[model samples]
Target: MNKRQILQLVILIIVILAGIRFYIYIDVLRSGGDAGVKTGIVEGFLPISALMSLKKFLLTGIYDYIHPAGLTLLIFFLIISIIFKKSFCSHICPVGFVSETLSHIGLKQRINKYLFHTLTILKYGLLAFFVYIILINLTVSAIESFLNAPYNIIADAKMLQFFTDPSRTTVIVLAVILLLTLISKNVWCRVLCPYGALFGLVSVFSPFKVKRSEENCTGCRKCTAACPNDIQVHTKSRIDTPECFGCFDCVNARNCDDCLKVTSGMNHKLLPYVIAVLLTLTVAGAMTAGLWKSTVTNQEYRRHLNVIDKLSH
Candidate 1:
């Protein structure tokens, strides 16, 4: 495997381990046993809670105690996007790794460029709706109310339950997405993930970008063909598109090294490692600051778990 794939695999394994630990912790709680530790890694899945927490933090300067890691991770991802242009999707996201793997199966097909572009709008629309609901519509009181709600307190457990015991509708939707991804490359990341849409929007201001040297170009179109995001790399001297994942597939595809390069003195091969280090440091910093773990007591978790099914958003 390449460096990028290796990094992604390592991250996926770590996340899986964390998920398993989290499941055992929750299962112990459900059985009225003392689950000594609670893993906060699952908080990464609670983006909506993180968004609400972000709003509260901005307004009052008080960080979320219930799921502080969620907000920390959300902020980390945004900062990463601003500097690295969606490197998280290419190098860290488990879902993105799964989608990439699925894309290698079956007959790889490409949707018409026009239709693909049209479908890409769906993610942006979903992001806009979320932005409106969380950032614009909700008042500070409403945000605080939701953040402290019983349902929100146990959202991580709920999310685990969602996958461990998925509803028929959820199963069907996931199956369809998987099937689509098998036929077409990165269908979910390219067209439907609101998280990716958010990152792509923020990445527009990133200083680093792919630069093509026309003088050194052979017009082989290998760079364009190698782009998983369907970005037309050969036709443009500079790729400033938000959709660019900074995967450097195009750069590696070039016949000549100088034909394709990243701007701002960044080495393409070292970029993924840089991202991995930054992610590690970010999580470490949060842990040092006592912000990586939830402040909710084990007793509180047990109390919430007892009525978890009765809680609603």
Candidate 2:
């Protein structure tokens, strides 16, 4: 199968895994006691805690116990961004899959160029603000306090409830975003996701890129039309845009035999296979190293779930 189809399958697998994790939590809640299964991978939704843990790790060399999985997941994605150019977003992110699916419901309508630029900048601005807040305010003690807070201990439960029992404001915001995405391809990923912006910045340093052969000499602009980020692919000999997701749609769009390809010193059609192997090994290594799960125990989760139950009601 082609890369796009492979990416869709990957997304489906991830979504299923996430669903199973959420099911474990819900089962525990329904049992009113230990159901004997807990999945820390769900903590990946807690990006704020991950950022705090990352800061603590940098300053003190202490790996975060409170949300170890979140921190590790964040690190894994950053590594992918460095090596594979934001493949996490294009190939693995469940939310990105949802956005892409929604955006494909109809033909995409273009927004004003000025408005599009402003919206694109908003994500970077949000990333900058978050970085500033985390860097300026974070300390070892602060991290400890935040991690140990009752609210944080029950955060996963709350996150689940946030979707299953969303507030009116949450419903409205999500509806608006979904509507926007239906009209424009990847409105959230391209214009409003801080995580995407973070990966975009890191991907700037990646050696891998889509390089065009100038001598091939066809400027059909098919690549530009296929680009979700609206990058001008036909004009450039090399695509160095941090906005590039390395989705390979541009390369695939070109009918010319040698006009375009994703390369790093050499062309390898099995690059996706290499990336998949690397990703699988990294996750497996992290699990075997005992860094995949959080330090929180079933007893702690039981107590935390009680608190979450109380808070929700």
Candidate 3:
């Protein structure tokens, strides 16, 4: 495995461990025991809540007390995209890691180009819908109300329950996604993830990008073939497309020296380590600021769990 893949594997393992710990923490609460473990890392999955909390924070000066870690992580990811060109998707996101792994084991079939482009719009549409609802439509008061509601307070627990006791529809939908990923590369990320779409948009302004030098061009298409996002790296002098993941697959695939280089960005060799250090610092800073954990107590979690089935948006 390459450095990027190594980083992804490490992050994926950490995420899995965090998930297990969170599950145990919630299980202890469900069993009327005080686990006293802080599993706020799972709040990374609660993006919608984080969005609402972010809006509220911008409108008012208050940070989300219930899921502070969610807001912190959302900000951290956005910043990473601004600086690193969607490296979070290729390096840190567990979903993207799973999608990448499935692509290796699966058929790796190619969809029609026209169909692929058409489906790519779906993720943008989802992102637009979310921006309309959370950023444009919701008033500060509405956001505040939602953030303070019992439904939002225990959103993390609800998310855990979702996987632990998935409905038939959830199972079917996930099965379809798994099948799709097995056949195609990054099916969810490329075609259906609003979070990735959001990052792609932000990454358009990123100073970092892939630059190709024609001086040493051998006209080989290895880089294009290596691109997981299917970006035609051989055709473009500069890859400014938001689809570029900056995972350095294309860079690593190049046979010609200096043919394709990441321009105006950290060196390809050190980018993964830089990302790792930044991630560590981000978490450490949040912890030092007392924003890495939620203010919700175990008793509150138990109380919310008792009535979570009846709660709705």
**Which candidate tops lDDT?**
1
What are the lDDT scores of the predictions, listed in order? Answer: 0.88, 0.78, 0.86
Clash count list over all predictions: 0, 0, 0
Worst 10 residues of 1 by lDDT: 102-111
Alpha carbon deviation, residue 35, candidate 2 (Å): 1.9
Count of backbone collisions in candidate 3: 0
In candidate 2, residue 276 scores what lDDT? 71
lDDT assessment of candidate 1: 0.88
* Clashing pairs for predicted structure model 1, backbone only: none
Higher-lDDT candidate among 1 and 2? 1
Model 3 over residues 263-305: C-alpha lDDT tens digits? 7736678888988999899999999999887888889878887
Of 1 and 3, the candidate ahead on lDDT is 1
Candidate 1, residue 42: the lDDT equals 93
Q: TM-score, each model?
A: 0.97, 0.90, 0.96
Q: What ordering of candidates by lDDT runs from best to worst?
A: 1, 3, 2
